[model samples]
Target: MELLPFDEYVRSLDRKRMSAGVLFRDAEGRVLLVEPSYKAQWEIPGGSVDAGESPWAAASREVREELGIERVFTRLLVIDYVPDDGRMPEGIAFVFDGGLITNAEVAALELTDPEIVSAGLFFLDAVPSLKATLAARLAIALRAAQAGEPLLSENGTELT
Candidate 1:
C-alpha cells in the first residue's frame, strides 16, 4: 500500500468527494478489518472518489490506496448518507464486499491518520464491537450477499 498524502491530495482536487467501503473476507470467511489511525473505531477499507469517478471505480481505487494491494472483486452493497452536525459536511457512502487474499503485502501501508493502527482477521462473532450503523450496514450487505428474504416488510409479515 502506498501512502500518498491523503489530505494533500484532498486539497488538490476541485472535485466533489464521495467514498465507498468494502467488507473484505479471507478464504476462511473471516473478516479483514482495519484499526484506523484516525478513527477510534475499526472500519472496512475505503475512501473518497475524485471528480469524474464512478462509485465502483472509486471503491477499487480507495481500496488499493488504503490497503496497498488491490484485490477487490467489489460489488455495491448500498448507499448511505450522514448529514452534517453543523460542524462537518455530510458524507455519501457506498458500501461493498470483497474477497481478500492472505498472501497480499498488507504490511506496506502506514495506516497513519489515526495512530497505533493495526489490522486483524475476526470471526463473525466479533462484529458486535462495530458502531451500530456500520454493524447494520454489514449485516444488510451480508444478508444480500447470501440472498436474503425478499418481499418482506420491516416486520415479520410479507408485503402485499
Candidate 2:
C-alpha cells in the first residue's frame, strides 16, 4: 500500500483561520468594542489564535496584548463557523465572557497594541450598525447572553 505524500494530504484539506475573542460589558450592560486601526469598523477584544494555542488562551492573550488588561473569562459564550469570504479564509470563531467591568476597569484599559486605536462601550443594540460582520456575530452573542449558555452559530445565525 502506498500513502499519499504529507504535503499532498495537507493541501487537500480546506485551510481555515481560527480566531478567539472575549465580550466585556459595563454595569449598564453596554458591550465593549475596540477600534482596530486596520479595519474600517470596530471589533470586540480578541485576535487570531496562534499555532498550538487553545481558543481560551488566545482570547486571554489577545485581550492582554491589545488592551493591557488582565481579566479572567467567565465562560464560553459562542462558537461561530464563518465561511470563507474572498478576502479572508473562513474558520471557527470563539467568544468568551470577560465578565462585567466597572468604570474604573474601563479607565484602566490601555491600547498597548499598535493595531488598536481605541476602546469604548456601546449598547448591544448598536453593535449591528458598526459593520456587517459584527451585526451577525453580535446576534449570537446576544442570544448567548440571554440564555446563559454556550451557542453554536454559522456566520452569526445561532444553530438550534
Candidate 3:
C-alpha cells in the first residue's frame, strides 16, 4: 500500500463526538435534573465536549455554566456509547459523580444560563421519563455509583 502523508492520514480518521455530564444527588436519594429551554425533557447537568477538551473538564465546565455553581467531580460513574440514530451522530457520553448536595444547596441553586430553565431534585422513578438511552445509561450509572464502581454502556444497555 502507498504511504499517505501525515496530514492526509490524520484527516482520514473518523471523528466521533463526545459529551459529558454530572450526576448530583440529594441526601434523600433524589437526583438533580435540569430542564433545558431548548428541549422538553429534563437532563443532567452537562453539555457537549468541545474540541481539545477532556471529558472531566467539560463536565466541570458544563456544571458551572449550566447551574452557576463550582463543583469538583472526582469519580466517573459511566461511559456510554450512543449509536447514531439519524437525528444525531453517534457519540460517547461521560457521566461523573457530583457527590451529594444538601437541601440548602439545592434550594439555593439559581440557573442563570439561557439554555437551562430550571433545576430540581427527583427520585429515580422519575428517570423513566427521560429519553430511552439516557434512562438506561443513568440506571447503570446510579448502580455503579452506589457500588463504588464505574460502568460501561452502549445505547443505555450495560455491557458484560
Candidate 4:
C-alpha cells in the first residue's frame, strides 16, 4: 500500500467551520446582544473566524467591526461544538469574556457594521429569544464567566 502525499492527506481531512464571539456584560449583569439585519434572532458580537485568524483575534475583530469599540479579551469562557444543522455546517465556537462594560461605554457604542441593526443588554432569561442553540451556549458561557472557569459544551449542552 502507498501512503498519500502530506499535502494530499491534509486536504483529504474534513474541514469544520469556526466562529468566535465576545460575551459582554453590564454592571447589572445583563448580557450584550446584537440584532443582525439579516436575522430575526439576536446574537452576541461575533462572526465566522477567517481562515488564517486565531479565535481570540476573530472575537476582537468582530467586536470592533460590529460595535466600533476596541476591547482586548484575554479570558475564554466557553468552547462549544455544534453539530451540522440543515442551514449550517458543523463547527466549533469560542466565547470570550468581555468582562463588564460601563454605561458610558454602552452609550458610546456605534453600530459601525451595516449587518448589525441594534445592540442592547438583556437579562439571561430574555436570551431565549435567540436561536435555541445560541441561547443555550450563551447561558452556559455566562455561567462559566461568572464562575471564573472555562466550560466545554456540545450542541449547547455542557459536557461532563
Model 1 over residues 1-160: C-alpha lDDT tens digits? 7766989888886533467778776676666677766767777777777778777788787666666555654466556665564765666667776755463544455554443367666665685356656655555555555563222222111123
In candidate 2, which residue pairs get closer than 3 Å at backbone N, Cα or C atoms, i.e. clash? none
Better of 2 and 3 by lDDT: 3
The candidate with the higher lDDT, 1 or 3, is 3
**Judged by lDDT relative to the true structure, which candidate is superior, 3 or 4?**
4
Q: Give all candidates' CA lDDT scores.
A: 0.61, 0.83, 0.88, 0.90
Candidate 4 stretches with Cα past 4 Å from truth are: 1-3
lDDT for each residue of candidate 4 in 1-160, tens digit (9 for 90 to 100): 9999999999999999999999998878788999999978899999999999999999999999999878787799999999999989999999999988876777788887999988888887776358888888988998898789999999999997
lDDT, residue 72, model 2: 64
Question: Taking the candidates one at a time, how many backbone clashes does each contain?
Answer: 4, 0, 0, 0
The full ranking of all candidates by lDDT, starting with the best, is 4, 3, 2, 1
Error of 1 at 136 (Å): 1.2
Listed per candidate, the RMSD to the true structure in angstroms reads: 11.1, 2.7, 1.6, 1.6
Candidate 2 structure quality by residue, lDDT tens digits, 1-160: 9889999989897767899989888778788888888978789999999989888889988998999877667599899998888888889999998877777777778787999988888886675337666666766786687789989988888788
C-alpha lDDT (0 to 100) for residue 58 of candidate 4:
94
